[model samples]
Target: MPRSWVDGLEARARASLPAPVHEYVAHGAGAGTSRDEAAAAWRDVRFLPHVLHDVTDVGLATEVLGTRLETPVGVAPTSLQRAVHPDGELAMARATAAAGGLMVVSSNAGSTFADIAATGVAWWLQVYLPSDRTLALPLLERAVAAGARAVVLTVDTPVVGSWEPAGDRVWDVVDPAFTRVNFDEGHDTQPGAEKALDLGPHDLDWLAERTGLPVVAKGVLRADDARRCVQAGAAAVWVSNHGGRQLDRAVAPARALPAIVRELADDDAEVYVDGGLGSGTDVLAALGLGADAAFLGRLPLWALVEGEHGVGRLQDRIRAELVEAMRLAGCRRVADARDVVGSPAPV
Candidate 1:
């Protein structure tokens, strides 16, 4: 079989980047079981494609939180892009815009929201509230002023996960200027600047009320948690395990998606997911499993290793692959992507 686009990009990125840099992007918490399992779980989902359907034109367009996307696949928030490439988030924003996909800017992004938004990409801000919730206000205010269409509140990392073996070396060597440039100078030294350990459902309400932008609760795995987020004023619930970086042995998004979708069956909230989703079929599987949209975490960063063009190329290829998969599965539109996966089984 030919090398997949993601595999090819990973190989090239690994070859071009320093070992530590590559390892940082690839590392998962603890035993790496969650990261390994995330990718494997999606493959276990068997596609139950319909027969004899006219799939001449497979539509990939979909609206996410009122923002229209030419493709259902979007780039997830990954930090320190400049650590791998000079252009950093700017390059990603440009490429994602060129491909007409959404880009989620990380709280720790190397570039300013103004610069990223200036790239003309439809973007959302992914945030981790600080112990002093007020610290996030300026950050949220800036992103909204920069034209962020939504806010993805990442609630998984009450504390950053422990990446054993690699430890702090993954981040210790990165220049401080290349990460979290959005915060005030010496922000880390301030009291309550650390990630809030007391994050709760009410925090979601606070963010929505404060920003006025639709809030998407990310890092949700449990159906109960997902339901609570919507109940707390979240416009959407993103099923994720922080790409297996935050919590080791957490349930993969692919495995946890069905439960969350069922939990929010009656609510008018959109469900998004990301984690080890690397192919068109993987995306198709996610949509078929009731996801409003599937996001890519690592692949875009790996593609960004070659700059904006690489990311754009990666998007084009994935879109093509998704179209083919949808056509084969008799999915003429994003909504029609449902009921294509077989009955759930243990992964």
Candidate 2:
């Protein structure tokens, strides 16, 4: 039998990465366990299979911030795509849209937002808050004009951390050629940024009042913070840990999903998560744990590094894996997968 697309893509990513990036990729893939250990851990949690239910028409369709998606799978934002491929974010946007998945374009993307928006897909702009609104406003204007349906304010990384292996590598190998287009020099110490550059409720409200676009608060890990996001007029809460790059011992977003969901469940804000997701079963686990959708990072980067053909192939493999997991768990749709697991205990 042929190797699955994910397996092939993982191999490609391992082969193509600089040694430092390869180490980071390996850390995320293993999820703090060795490959064999992670697989063994996953095996210990078997799905309680249900039979005798009619599951002939499995629907994978879902929506995020009012945009209909063909599948619950989406491309999560990652910086510096050119390191992965020459086509960069352009190739990722087109391929993900072609596969009926959504794409979240990073503010730090190597390709311009205007270039990515031209693909005519359901794309969201992921922004890192600058100390000054002057630098942020122009980028926000450009994203809205370019047809971004939503703006995801990533509140993590107030100051870039010391443990970012990828950032260090990018600085050494890639940054001389690629500067952050959205930031001006000295923007980091502007007034009102003395504290960490978190986009608080006030910040969210200010942005919403200004842009009139659906605002989402990404990197929300606490329930109180999730509540504040909705109060600040956010359309959704994105729970993540920058794929474990920021804080080494932070609980995986999957473990934090249920509480975050429960806190904001009445606020009508969607909850999305990303971290340690590799297969369809992992996606299903996220939904079961209370996520509206699962954002895939690194995996798509792996595909991009593999080349143009790799994108569609990787998407297909993941979608198929999701469908199979849903079928086995007796779910005929993404919505059905939501109720597949009981409430999770605290991590």
Per-candidate TM equals: 0.97, 0.87
lDDT per residue as tens, model 2, 42-114: 2333355567767887889988888889999898988767766777788898888798889998876777777
lDDT per residue for candidate 1 within 1-347, as digits (tens), equals 23366678888999998878888899899988999999888888888898899998778999999999999999999987998899999999999998889999998999998999888999999999999999888888998899999999999988889885655675666787888888888778899998898999999999989999999999999999998899999999999999899889999899999999999999999999999898888899899899999999999999999899889888888888899899888889999988888865353
Those runs of model 1 whose alpha carbons end farther than 4 Å from true positions after fitting are: 1-5, 345-347
Write down the lDDT of every candidate, Cα atoms only: 0.90, 0.74
**Consecutive 10-residue window with the lowest summed lDDT within model 2:** 33-42
Model 2 TM-score?
Answer: 0.87
Off by over 4 Å in 2: 1-5, 20-46, 164-167, 175-198, 342-346
Model 1 residue-pair collision total? 0
Which numbered prediction scores highest in lDDT against the true structure?
1
After the best TM-score superposition of candidate 2, give how far the Cα of residue 294 lies from its true spot, in angstroms: 0.4
**TM-score winner:** 1
